[model samples]
Target: MDGTMSGVGIDIRDDGLARVTLRRGDAGNAIDLTTARGLLDAATACERSGVRAVLLSGEGRSFCVGGDLREFARFEGEALEQHLLAVTGALHEALRVFARLDAPMVAAVQGAVAGAGIGLAAAADVTLAADDASFTAAYTGIGYSPDAGVSWFLPRLAGPKRALDLLLTNRRIPASEAVEIGLVSRTVAAGLLADEAARTAEVLRDGPAGAFGATRRLVAAGLTADLGPHLDREARALAAAARGEEGREGVAAFLGKRPPAFRSAASPF
Candidate 1:
């Protein structure tokens, strides 16, 4: 694996899986400006590395506790405003990059997921929470607004009404309820998080990357765009994929009754 460590740790393995870890365990992986920059850097690196899948997780008791209150407490007035602007800029860029990337993203979450942590989980294509995991939109309690795409993804995932409930009330929802409400893809035992995430990542990494990427973009666009334009977009994407090497291999594999070799040297993603 090719690895780098900072506030965020990125390890791009041989199988083209990028493992992104939030490294601030002692601090519940809270995002300070520096950590936000690290996140952006890690995401940029993932795009540049041509990885086929991404696995995001935090290193400790919680996935993340959101913005570092201690860090925020240090600034005042204009200084505070500028600091927050810079922090959110970096954080948003990272999430945008991951969302637009060809590689699919999966998150393994445990412990507390609060504030911007909810954004992270929402942003992932699939999120697997440990049974002990809990989610809370802690922004209102702290007299802050949502950031890190929480306002965007949450409304779509849980519907505007339910999303408002979480955003306004700051009520804590455990993994089971999160799943019931579609806030998370599913829940697993805490001990199974790593293995399940890894397995899911591997499956995505070995799949038809181009098709997966196109489908992801389509889904995201469908949420906002009208049907006619969306259909045009889908048609173009399908035609493009059908002309690609991966598409040819998928068809050939089916005819041959064999698994598709999406990772072959000449494969198109």
Candidate 2:
């Protein structure tokens, strides 16, 4: 099923893939109140449908330029403050929902990526940028601060010093530099961006879903977990996975020298 809500497009495929596109391309896909709510709705839909993977992309030249400053400019004083709070509240909740999903998300970014756009890209499990893409932390440029998990994601992805440099300078960096600094997974030719992202998402969708979910949680937790406790957690997860349908099928397939049908195997996650 496919639907367009405000400035966001959601397409849930029969193969368990959710394609979420930012549809306000003419406005550089800027996030307004409606767009923020739409994203939350889309994320909620994907979760309800139990999609195995998600692919995020834009409709036009730019992925997203960040929050709609033009919209914000219309309000003043407490009105403006309240408007911003609503916007960030919806956007941040959407990000949290996406992050907690068992499905992995892949983002295909092109052209300009700035402000909260950086947060969306960084939040993805894998971010594929086109060679023509460029990134900038644009919040500081407008006398605003970071939102949409940018402050948290940046430091973790690119190191504290680099994150601070990007945030403070608001300098645009090429896709090459983004990959080198661990801001993105890899860069692809602009023409191939869509196809490559879809291919990657398809692979993830076909993999073992339950194991992927557990692994995702484990990796995120490992960042702050101590070695001893983390190892114990890993042991419990491994043991549980071994008894699951996907794991049993995987082992059987290996011994039989056959490819495992992970999609057919029921996932307990």
Candidate 3:
């Protein structure tokens, strides 16, 4: 599948890799209502297609600059409130779908990543930012609170205190600092960002899909699960994986001193 939905582009390859790109480069990929709906549509397609991996990126200098204030400025009072609600509702639902996916997501961000952009980047299992990238929590600066899971993800990724500092102060941090604070996975040269992101997504696509899904669920559950119960969950997951076809292939490959063919051995979701 290859098409553009509003300002979002969806390209799903035969190799089970989905590329979702923010296509409104001239508008800084801002999340207008149409863009929000487009994102949800793209995410839904990926889930339905059972894509093994997703790569999210932007087409221009900046990944995204957050909500389109210019569009919001057109409304007032109840109209503005209604408009924002629709925007956030769709955007949040898109994030929820992406989070629940068995496939992993990789975000390649460059230039400005602010507000909702930060949330989108943080939502990824792995986020690769260009060395020239900059991040900021622009919500407070605009007299608006956060949407797009920014409030939820930041506290977990960067710690509560750091998250608050960024949110309250609206400070812009470089990609290096973002990595240091755990806001991003790593920073690559601007020119290498696309290749690195594609490489990472391809690696994930070629991995054991079932095992990867289990691992993703485990980590997300572990974040809030109690130690004892989490261990039990882990045990159950491990046993199931060990009894599956991928497990047998992996063991056989090890004994034969050969790389495992996880993609071929794994079952469909």
Candidate 4:
């Protein structure tokens, strides 16, 4: 859509917010070689976008349909293995970058978010949704297993039983139910989704850039490793950064009973 023949479409508005939209609505935002590469490229672009926040969403009815069946139809044995390797490897690398972004990521899900889309959303720091949003594991029902890091994200977010049940049954979970199940952070009206997402990003943009990144790192570390060390590291970083320019401004503003302005761009990791 960006005048390029890629499966995914990426556009960054001047406000420093990048939106990665799955443009292949005809086949849903199914994962293909082009899409996979496009995904990595988009993540790289976002990392350099100078945007304080990023949102991953879709352009049409469905968020993403899953892997492209058309691409897989040509697979035999070794060729299939090669294709899978390339796609998954590229995606995982991009996920690591996306996860380490300094500013928060809020995945805005609307309509259908299936399979790999779940994996993508789970990688985000936060997820917001519309009531019509629905989720499906959509792997086993098709005689295939999970890919695009779905296995890792699903079990961690939804728990083992929940993950297994969804993958096995391919049941649909609506946005409201998803929040209740701890799958999404908030559910908003479909019409206000864009405005809401922008507002949230703006709020984070006003905060200290270093503090935001440090806090995100702490949460991620706590999720995967020991909580004590994570807190300890966070405390140390906060103390050190508090002496910097941004932190000095924050302190002065608080003492003056005013708001402190901050730059939007920050480090990726």
Candidate 5:
């Protein structure tokens, strides 16, 4: 169940709960060019594995510190812009894959969640933070605009005003206040963060697969789609879920007074 895939480490349970951990803890789990590609590779593997849920975390004191500034410093002008483009391209691909997957993402965040790290954490369908976990939009402080989908995810998550406040001020917020501001779903004791995240992932694994995925899609589309097309999308999604195996099993199980065994479904993406 445990192996290294690209620069990321994966542990897949028989029940289809996959753990995707950032492996460069020694370096604060910074996202270098290699790590960006590694993330895409790991996400692709997860899709192929038919994972029902994913628990994302890092191996050390920090969840992720964002891009590797040291690596960025190695370039200048056009070289820097090109390097950034390459890094964001890979990172965006990974994020897109995860967003399109049926499996729900649960991020177990601790320590620092800064810059692009903030985007990574925000992208999760649900995020569980350690009591000591902290969040900051470090992009502006470093004279950079947002990347890694932070600009897209933050406003929807923390509201436009609050999102801009974080982006412009680069103020660090503790986990407790993070929950208040809708930055994280919940906070747990630092020692129990792993267990809590796994429990959340297991809950998601047991959920009705197509229905859950459809719900995520509906919510996301509601943010941008016009009311008419959004409603059409929802209708189609619901009908598709109703025609799926999990939907039938769910209905039958309810009628029979039994637990539904909702198996993992391959992501359409």
Candidate 6:
């Protein structure tokens, strides 16, 4: 991805994971209009490429400090809201696309994750962080309300009280504390974090793809549809999955008391 001016350095690897890196290392990998636009393209590219999952990371030491303040100089009267809407609209679109997939997303967060950076991380299905990483909201400190998905994602992941405290106080939380408060999935050793995340993602990718997707839909059902429709959807999906080859293999393995092979199976099974 060529976003030199934007500083949104996106690299898509053929290993079935795209890395959307914020590259403004000088300013802590801050997001700018160009960067946000680049991010929009990157998200589209990932889905278009059919990657099972994307691994969001940073190129430099910092994940993303926040939106670029230098660009703040360009802000005009009514254009302010329009500009924010333009870029953040891209962010929400990306989140919507990523949310549709059941492939487990693993965010490898390190260094500082502040402001909109938290939104990006929360968009992922799972997050893996170094024990030393730090997370902060920092929006109010700079005279802005949370523009990212913080309002929607944070409270659910980290719990209402913790999310409220962080957003209101603009406080920074250590990665260890984040784990304790449910902000991150878990803390890993600095050097092994990437490998650990990869292992987890592999486990997900190797599992029953349709079933996994259906499971995700079931779990997230509570956010919208009611009990009757929810159960109907769940039953339909589960039945479909159970009728497939993976389900047959799983059942055979259970009866035989042996691990059945999944990587190879008969067609239309």
* Model 5 agreement with the true structure over 125-231: per-residue lDDT tens digits: 99999999999989989899999899988888889999999999999999998898777999999999999899999999888767877898898889888999988
Q: CA lDDT of 136 in candidate 5?
A: 91
- Mind sharing the TM-score for model 5? 0.93
Q: In model 6, where is the ten-residue run with the lowest total lDDT?
A: 260-269
On the 0 to 100 scale, the lDDT of residue 129 in model 2 is 100
lDDT (0-100) at residue 235 of candidate 3? 97
lDDT of 4 at 60: 75
Q: RMSD for all candidates, in order, please.
A: 1.4, 1.3, 1.2, 2.7, 2.2, 3.4
Candidate 2 wrongly placed segments (more than 4 Å): 267-269
Off by over 4 Å in 3: 267-269
Question: In candidate 1, which residue ranges exceed 4 Å CA deviation?
Answer: 265-269
List lDDT for all candidates, in order.
0.91, 0.94, 0.94, 0.77, 0.88, 0.75
Whole-model lDDT, model 1: 0.91
Each prediction's TM-score versus the true structure: 0.97, 0.98, 0.98, 0.90, 0.93, 0.85
Pick the winner on TM-score between candidates 2 and 4: 2
**Residue-level lDDT for 104 in candidate 3:** 94
The stretch of ten residues in a row with the least summed lDDT in candidate 4 is 260-269
> lDDT tens digits, residues 1-269, model 3?
99999899999988799999999999999989999999999999999999899999998999999999999999999999999999999999999999888899999999999999999999999999999999999999979999889998999998999999999999999999999999899999999999999999999998888888899899989889999999999999999988999888888999999999887876353
lDDT of candidate 1 at residue 172, scale 0 to 100: 95
Please give the distance, in angstroms, between residue 127's alpha carbon in candidate 5 and its true position after superposition.
0.4
Score candidate 3 by TM-score against the native.
Answer: 0.98
Q: Count the backbone clashes (under 3 Å) in each candidate.
A: 0, 0, 0, 0, 0, 1
Instruction: For model 2, state the Cα shift of residue 44 in Å.
Output: 0.3
TM-score of 2: 0.98
Q: lDDT of candidate 4 vs native?
A: 0.77
Clashing pairs in 1: none
